[model samples]
Target: MNSEVILTCAVTGAGDTVGKNPNVPVTPKQIADDCIAAAKAGASVAHIHVRDPATGGVSHDPAHFREVMDRVRDSGVDIVMNITAGGGGDWIPDPADPTRGGPGTDIQTPAERHHPVGELLPELCTLDCGSLNFGDMVYVNPADWLREHARLVQAAGVKPELECFDLGHVWFARQLQQEGLIDADPLYQLCLGIPWGAEADTETMLAMRNKLPASAQWAAFGIGRQQMPMVAQSVLLGGHARVGLEDNLYLRKGVLASNAQLVEHAASLIENLGARVMTPARTRDHLELRGAQTGGEA
Candidate 1:
């Protein structure tokens, strides 16, 4: 088992959770605060996704991203910034015209999707390995699109967190590595429990983790109730852990959770298991991260 672990907190994802949980951050300041709080609570990295402040919905505006980045950087937090480059891939079929995209269909070219990551240049950014049936919609990241996106991320000198939602995604991610698109020691995040994606279980996590490159740095997270269980399982399986409001809304049954609480709980779990939490500096070194300031190392 891995004795030292890096815990990442995905502060606010671009999901329909604002109404469900009032504490879910929407504005740039709130998102930045949550990132700082999670770092103070022992999260080595913060995975970020900005929402439209007026509507509190998913957004791809570089201005919004810049505001959030500025706040986080100015806050003097030592945590690594991991911006979400996996946006703009949602596709919903039109009820009237089934052949084309629908009202909720938000797709973009590789350059458009990579705009924020390229402009702000976060230390780490996520690249969803492949597409999957996400509830009624489909998250459409095709092979060619992924190839171009990976190349773009590589040229930006940022580490792409290969987000694998299923077994096929793992296979595809390995293909990207073999083609040398992933420059640094590839970082992987086995995303579980999304609709129609990989199931949240020990066997599934192990299968996905085992398929990773031997030199790759990997972590796994489960959505909803399986979040904490997967953290323990990941660590026991010699991988890192991820937690925060992005993946789970509740700290326990019927309890809404903040990003910091989730990070605190994950840190406690790592310590209780006879392992120490890796700091942001250590994570940067381990993952070979490129950007972000070291204002106040946690």
Candidate 2:
């Protein structure tokens, strides 16, 4: 394990998790509270994704994001905000007409996909590198779209975390790097265990990590039962770690967990492995991020 490992706590994701876990925060207030709790518990960064208050589904409402950010700021916690630009990519092709999209497919233009990041201007935002077949719906991000979003994020002065879900996605991200669309020493988040992406296993992660550029700052996460295993794997690989209810719901069998609990568990594991957990302040310094507006320390 690396001596200095940064731990990120992903707040409520934009999945259909509200019904699966009672602890998943839905409204802006609940989401903000969850993020604050995670930061207080020892998360260096909070990876956030908002949901609709009425339906508990994915939402791209900038107002909702504003509310969450305000609450987090008002709480005085020093968590590095890392919002998602990966939503609005789900595409369910119409069964009747394969050329058309079906219901539940919330595809948006590159500008719309990255609009929130431009408005929020967080220290960090994710830019998914490529599309993958996510079960029934295809998570689509063509190269042209990715290029546009990359430019927009770079222009906004926000660091883009290249989110690679598969091997090909990594290749695409490297292409962006070579094109100078990404910043120096780019950050990466390898999303493993999604339906058609890389498996959440040591070999798979090792392969991807070995393929990364020498100067990349990277983190890896797995979903469901693979989450904890990937945490240990990522740490051992000298990379950052992430955990939250967004990826996994249970701390143990039949035991639902809160975001803070998940982050605490990751912190403990990192500590037990003789690796120091970086606070949000340290993380900002390490990542070369501009300090938050409130000047809160991690």
Candidate 3:
């Protein structure tokens, strides 16, 4: 019943979703426009991930991110930009060697993964808490690497959103907080329903929420069909909600959706739950986020 639930729209993920959904935005212009639409529809935050235009594959290119940032700023969307610093950690290890990596691995240094955040210095950025068996491949992020990344991101004056895929990851995030690697008013994104990660259900969400530090601020999102359900759950449980093409592509069964449509749906649900969606400016103030930079004057 609290009117404090902030809505975040993850425009397009770095997943293999472009081919699956025609509505998925590929170009920077399209992505920015989608983000603007989402903001218009009541999304307080816009989480971004750039892709390779040629293959529609995930990319860590800072130039692509720059293009997206420029376009979003130029559009004057009034949405908090939260860039992903979680890419470039994928590793498909060689079965034969076991030590060396195999092809299809987009392995890069932690610094490489954070290049966009370091350069652009968005109001918010993601810091994936732990490594996991992401499907068949291993998403590698050791503790040392994460500590270094936390230090670098904090130093850059960007608010780090701790993304935890499981309970153990949350534990690691707490360790980071205890070590003062992250700020006191830390933000967390509870990612559920991923392959081999936390399950998407009320019990799992409640358990994770209960474990969070008292000083921590957080949001919860579920993938696919559980996405909308978690929106209501998150709001009812005193947390924010996120939804969009990144987490889901369908507005309903067999119905394709644009990012704005997802935001609209989320807003309706929040309103139904007796909660009102906050604007980006309000969200920035609520989370104590640094103000965004004006690149192209949007």
Candidate 4:
């Protein structure tokens, strides 16, 4: 088991959850505040995604990201910023015409998706290792695209949190490392419980975690009701943990939760499991992240 766990809270994911949960932060200011709240509640990192403030829909706007980053930095909080590069992959194919993109299709070049991360230059950012049938939509992160994305992220001097949704993704991650695309020490995020991808059960988490490079530092999270359970499972398996409104909304059955509540709950679970939660300083040291804020390798 991991003696010290780095807790990350993915605040305000690009999902249709604002209408369902009033506590979901929509605007840039709200999102930044949520990050601060997560930090105060014992989160070492904040995995962020911007939204169209007016519609609460997923937005790839660099302006929104800048505002959120500025607000968080200006707040005097010391949480590690982990921006999202997982946007522009939603592919809801047209029902009638298979060749045409449907109304919900939002695909973009690797450069377009990496624009915000390259511009903002956060310490850590998510680089989805591979594509999978995410629910009804095919979240396309093709191998070539992934290679290009990895190169771009490396050029920008950012550490990627390899989001592995399946065992194949873990395999592909190792290939990227073997090809010298990824940095010396890789970081993995075992994304679990998403539809048509890796399941939330213990067996799947173990299978994916076992596939990581021995030198890799990793964390795992499960969506919806399995969020807390995965926190325990991840720590027990010697990996870090993530929790927030991005993955799960409820604190308990029929009870809505804020991002801070989720972090606090996860922190409690980690402590109860005889593992101490790592602070922002310790997490940066552990991950060897780079950025102006961390003062390592800018």
* Best-performing candidate as measured by lDDT: 4
Clashing pairs in 3: 73-298, 76-298
lDDT of 4: 0.93
Please list the C-alpha lDDT of all candidates, in the order they appear: 0.91, 0.89, 0.89, 0.93
lDDT of 4 at 2: 97
lDDT of 2 by residue, 157-237 (tens): 999989999988889999999999998798989999999889999998999998899999999999998888899899999
RMSD of each: 2.1, 2.0, 3.2, 2.3
* lDDT by residue for model 3 (82-158), tens: 99999988888888887888887887788898899999999999999999988788888899999999999989999
Clashing residue pairs in candidate 1 are: none
| Candidate 2 segments exceeding 4 Å error | 292-298
Tell me the tens digit of each residue's lDDT in model 1 across 23-51.
89999889999999999999988899999
After TM-score superposition, what is the CA distance of residue 148 in candidate 4 from its true location, in Å?
0.5
Candidate 4, pairs of clashing residues: none
**Model 3 spans > 4 angstroms off:** 95-99, 292-298
Q: For model 4, how does the per-residue alpha-carbon lDDT over 129-247 read when each residue is reduced to its tens digit?
A: 89999998899999999999999999999999999999999999999999999987899999999999999989999999888999999999999999999999999999999999999
Candidate 1 lDDT at 231 equals 94
What candidate 4 gets wrong by more than 4 Å, as runs, is 291-298
